[model samples]
Target: MKRIMLTLILLVGIGGYTTYAQSELSLQECLKYALTNNQQLARIRMEEDMGRFKTSEVRAKALPQVNASGQYTNNIKKQVLAVPGELIQEPGKTVLLEAGTTHNVTASGTLTQTIYDQSVFTGLKAAKAGEEYYSMQSVQSEETVIYNVTQLYYSTLVSREKMIVLDANIEKISKLVNTTGSQVESGLARKIDLDRMRVNLTNYKTQRTQAQNQYLVQLNQLKQQMGMSMAASIDLPHTSFKEIESKAVGALDFGGVNLDNRIEYRLLKKQEELQEFQKKAYKAEYYPSLALSGNYSYNGISNKFDMFKGSGSTASWYSMAAVSLTLKIPIFDGFARRSRVSQASVTLKELNKQKEETALALNTQFENAKLQVQNNLTTIQAQKENVDLANEVYNSTQNNYNLGLANLTDLLDAETSLTEAQNNYNEALLQYKLAELDIIKSNGNLKSLLN
Candidate 1:
């Protein structure tokens, strides 16, 4: 008997551990992990980084760049000549350019300052504009990150909640089976009642198993997407969808309202501005440019490659500076510049269209979300009544069975009905939670709430 009791206690412990492993996870932690660690977010952030560097690159072009150069020459043979009279006497003969070991070396520093350059200026400005555009895109990406995290988090919550409902039903059905077994042993119920109970219990068990599997799968997926470590376990918090569902069913604080706060809307606006910048830059391409540049050098020549020994060499230094003006008259280029302007203009028009289309789509989505939440809330209200009614019916039938007024069949039917109604209530609660989350997401408020 002690051995049997020990075995039972171990089984219970195992069951408890399993239940705890499937516990509720916190929303805040999930969102944090997902935003910071998700691979998609990381990739998008890399793009944003590239944009930042590009912006710096654009700015760098406007600054002066200094350069240095050096040169060395060695003569295999030193040409000899009398300073002047000997060179005149030897005019018929080949006269060398230098005497003794001849060496030529030059080192210089040059600076080019762009006083003005139409193309560079325009390109720099465009690069800056591009960076701003990418930064705006990152904003949109952040919204996307928020959206994806909420979706997976809430979706997993829903699945786990659904599994809880199934598990409850399974428990209730198991109890019914036990009750029927008792009745059969007492010869008060037919064997068929026990068989029916077994079948119902088996069905509920199957459903519970499926729900459990789905819950685990969703949990794993959420964990992986959030870049959670395998060693860390997910524990979801138990949340009731009742009040949220009720609110969703009614008109929200923002019914038939526009969410200009949406990233997509703002992104489209930025795109329009970007197009304008491009058009302006294209226009600026026709302007002229001016720049200033100068260089200085030091040279020492000798038979040796010494830096300081240069007595035998003619060492002289010269410097030059110039101001330049460039005129890009845009004489003709097959109308390519005009074509680019047209392209930019066309893009602006397309962005306008895109803005319109996105607004419409968002409106449709919010409307649908509103309707779903309201409908689910209505369902919850009705399911609540059904649960109460089923509970009453089960109680009455069980009382009758105990008093020998109703048979096992009636009691079993009542039990099954009550179980189903309870499960339906659970489903209604979860639907309400999900619907509310959807509304928030549609309004572009997921970031504010989750992150």
Candidate 2:
């Protein structure tokens, strides 16, 4: 019996844990989760790392480069050297003697160091700029992810609230249908009225099903934006209509949005910076470069395989060394460097144009977002009042219908009005939230959402 009780207790504990695991997630939690798990953001981070490695590679050019080489040869047929016979005291005759050893081995090491290379220096600077460019891109990508996730999160919340409203309407109308049927049986209500109530109840149920399905679809989309698994069961916390209205009403103004705050504008500026570096790099090609090279080698020659043993004078080994400094003057290249510099200057001008355009566009976005925020705030207030009035009318009509002072049609109409008002109010809140998110992004404060 004790074992049975223990098993029951363990089962209950597991069930509770499962329920807790699937509990509702708030907006902050969702944003934080996306930042950590988003696949796109992860790729951007890897690209940033690639930029750093690229810079390292360019810097490596300035360091001394060393290499080793070895070769072994076994001559099958040595070439004969023909000499004048008179020189060997044999008149009017030619003599032939074989040249070179049967076996030969050589090993060498070399080092090359750049003393003054204009191109390598330019490349190092360009690489550093590229790394910074990638870093900015990463930040921009994160902001985009945060904006998308926040938008989807609130959209899902709105859909869920609509579904809730429909469910409540169904429940209320179902009760009305039951009451009307009893009235018709007792001769207090006509059969037509009972049938009408049943039809309305059926319609509400159908509408509720659609609303619930839409809510489910939206929830799945929210999970997708959050980088959560499709197979995972998750819930979103419910936000009341009144709370939404209050939040919208209290929307803060981010006065005088700075173009520098917006990541898009900053990215453009960073591009301009990189283009300037590129222009300098192209111009750097006109300059000369100097390098120092050193080499050391060991040669071994023998008629037998005894070079490593160094046995007697039959096998011989010698060491050779050389050092030289080379200067490469860019005398001419068919005016290629001049043409490249001209193109870079043109590109810089284009980038300057882009920066100007981006600045104007960013300003326009901020202004439009602020305008929308104001408009949504007004709509939310009006809708909030409409909802309250509709609820009052619904309650009064419902009570009157119960007392036979109102017809089923009037009650149904009032319920419809209430449902519309509630949905409109929720829609206004969603628009306001979206506009607020835009304001935050335009002000370069999307990361504030995580806080």
Best by the lDDT measure: 2
* lDDT score, candidate 1: 0.69
Clash pairs (backbone) in predicted model 2: none
Model 2 has a clash total of 0
Query: Model 2, 168-203: lDDT tens per residue?
Result: 888887877787778788998899987887887788
Highest TM-score scorer:
2
What is the C-alpha lDDT profile of model 1 across 1-451, one tens digit per residue?
0000001111332321212233333566456657777776678778888988987887777899789998877877776664544556854455545674566777888887777766667777677777777777776776676666666666666676667766766776687678778978999678887797788778878887887788777777765676554445555544555555456346556445455767778778877876787888787676666667777777665565564545543444344444444434556778888889899999998999999898998888888888887788788888888989999998898788778899867877887788789778777766666677778777777676553
Give the clashing residue pairs of candidate 1, or none: 23-236, 24-235, 24-236, 24-237, 25-235, 25-236, 25-237, 249-374
| Candidate 2 deviant stretches above 4 angstroms | 1-24, 91-96, 241-244, 247-252
Ten residues in sequence with the least summed lDDT for candidate 1: 1-10
What's the true lDDT of residue 161 in model 1? Answer: 65
